[model samples]
Target: MAASVEHDSLESMEAPQTAVEVEETKTFKDLGVTDVLCEACDQLGWTKPTKIQIEAIPLALQGRDIIGLAETGSGKTGAFALPILNALLETPQRLFALVLTPTRELAFQISEQFEALGSSIGVQCAVIVGGIDSMSQSLALAKKPHIVIATPGRLIDHLENTKGFNLRALKYLVMDEADRILNMDFETEVDKILKVIPRDRKTFLFSATMTKKVQKLQRAALKNPVKCAVSSKYQTVEKLQQYYLFIPSKFKDTYLVYILNELAGNSFMIFCSTCNNTQRTALLLRNLGFTAIPLHGQMSQSKRLGSLNKFKAKARSILLATDVASRGLDIPHVDVVVNFDIPTHSKDYIHRVGRTARAGRSGKAITFVTQYDVELFQRIEHLIGKKLPVFPTQDDEVMMLTERVTEAQRFARMELREHGEKKKRSREDVGDNDDTEGAIGVRNKVAGGKMKKRKGR
Candidate 1:
């Protein structure tokens, strides 16, 4: 009955306690973090605890199971990482903790944070996710790292097939983005994992929202969990300046170019709805000398990492991506986010815009709402509880770019078709060029060199 009541209240979207109540004067030491870990936090430049960290860490240190409700980029990683590290320090063990995330990229990112925070103590972590050879991952698991971070699907593959490996003594279990994990249809895998791991272990479930699925998972996974919700409602950050541009669907590329030109020197992350559009738009932007790149599920794992590294390193100014990049992976220098294609799910808008305006930094999000997307746009507005103003763009300025954009579009489509045909012609071409990297490589050989010289134009 208590579980049912808790579900009802969370379903109603009431935050148990607002994060604003957390005292700003509180530091990592105040949250009961160990001295070494506290110093590690300082070295990483995290001088103070974020609200989620402040609320969740103390209870976690007291050995309470936690259901942390916070928005994306709210330092959810630290809230759980500190306590897990604290426990690890007290009781040293191999295969100490397991972190499950929705995407492979997020798995690597969490591993980085755990290593950074636990570095002084020489903590070892292995990232187990798909798109990499299982043999390598098997060897990684064989070493029995202190922590193993993985996505649900690949982790299951290892559990069933890998020899001489098991989490029989696992101490901590963390589902970083619980809502997205379930949403990706990993319910069965999660259930299997839950059955294998010891229930006596500490568990932390963190998510951006409390949906019915998450409520069910919470009942199944957590035991008398303390709910620490930082943001009670669905909303964007205060520092984000959000606007919308209503234009014909055909003219999206033109307007995108105009905005990129207008906001020159600013880093941009443009979200597309499909993998094809993401690749095509990236090619178009690259052709126009915008230093564009693409990150999506179709690319090989290595290429995906390369694209992300280039974007993060500022080697590339524009990253065209599918919804896969929208959730938990943080690239801190983004100045603008363009929803080149509006998201079908209204809730995704929050996560997409969240790519920017992170860590107290100001940023901009401009969504392109075509006539077909009006209903979806309205739903997003209604969800966020505010109507977005139209972004200022001169029609003539946008129209002037149509000729060049059209040529780029034609070249992009041709490149995609030619690449697809090349893949069919040779079986050896299967692995590397199977996604965006090969297409980009082909562009370099075919026309990117010529386009590179015209970048400043």
Candidate 2:
């Protein structure tokens, strides 16, 4: 406890010094980034450094370990990537750096950023995560990539089992989303990983909030780190217009459809509390003729990545996701966010709403608050330091949606039950190939029952 307090004080005291120094540095080149990397940043359309990048890049270039505190969408990846790429340039070697992330999605996203930034230098990166074949990963490790981005559990699996592979000469280590990494209870695996990596390597820890677990991890991992905090307080971006809708739990789907129609032509992300709810709501929306998709922990990794790619490509306009998509995965063009279920924790409210209004763009967020979620909604309001205005709706117009939504709900439930049976049978007869293509075909066969739009809202 005493050490954590001392660490907090030290971080607070040193945070401002770097903030003051960052003002004079306007560009990545000004922050000691190499000419090649600056050009690569230009090609990627990053004209200027973000706040986190501006603060951490210069210090990292000077060979100092760093602890960065920044919110989601604050360009934390660039802050750590630039320094690691720069170091690799000066002293090029395979397996030069390792980044440990909390989720497979986040790990893949980081690898994409690294490859983009280091395109000119021919930097190779391997993503090691779960739900994928380990045999293929063994081949990737055999080829000796320059950087390895991974989750803790799978990385430990490789360290113990993979033949002729090690990180004894690694020069840099990064734990992105350090707080979430610890919160998911990967502490034992993380400890095991730390025991093997070289203590002389530089470590950079980036997290949204500083929890006790994160503070403890900082002491265990980083060495005399300089703290670079962009926003220590929990708050949403200025361009976000947040609102709430209070309705009965039974009428939740009706209100959701009304809102989607009201905000047509805009891309949306809807947050749900459970995987089952996410899948059910997605089927319901799809039956109503909306371009809806589901992303949850239960799906195969290829399907999960396919869902994200389809959403990003705008082939699908609505993504119904559990909290798995909430943190550290960047999809920059979201125009609105809907909290279909209010988060039990207030801090998640910030991250969910943060998905939109990103990078100085204007966006909206509407949260659905059922009677049972009053206390949760109030806690969210308290955390954000303001009461959300009610989203205007004509009760009669919403009521008109009830019959159509109810019909769609019936179809959705039927499809879900049939899909579950198919999955079970497939697992017994063959491998778990549970293809969504056949499921969608079935929906098309029953498309005659889908309700047509009622005129004159």
Best by lDDT: 2
Clashing pairs in 1: none
**lDDT score for candidate 1 against the true structure:** 0.86
* Poorest lDDT segment (10 consecutive residues) of candidate 1: 435-444
TM-scores for all candidates: the values are 0.91, 0.91
lDDT by residue (1-457, candidate 1, tens digit) is 8666765564355343433336444688877898999999999999888888887898899887899998878899999999999999999999999999998889889999999999889999999887778899999999999999988888888899999889989989999889999888889999999999998899999999999999999999998888888875898899999999999999989999999999999999999998788888888887787788988877767778888999999998899898888889888889999999999999999999999988789999999999899999999999999989999988997899999999999988987776566645544554433221123322222223334455646
lDDT of each: 0.86, 0.86
C-alpha lDDT (0 to 100) for residue 85 of candidate 2 = 97
Candidate 2, 1-457: lDDT as tens digits: 6546755775777666556766677789898999999999999999999988987898799887899999889999999999999999999999999999988889999999999999999999999987788899999999999999998988998999999999999999999999888878889989999999899999999999999999999999988787888875888888999999999999999999999999999999999998778888988998788988888766777777888999999999999888878999888789999999999889889989999999889999999999999999999988889989999999999999989999999988987776777656655765442222112111111112222321111
Runs off by more than 4 Å, candidate 2: 1-23, 429-457
Instruction: Kindly report the root-mean-square deviation of model 2 from the true structure over all alpha carbons.
Output: 5.2
Clashes of each: 0, 0
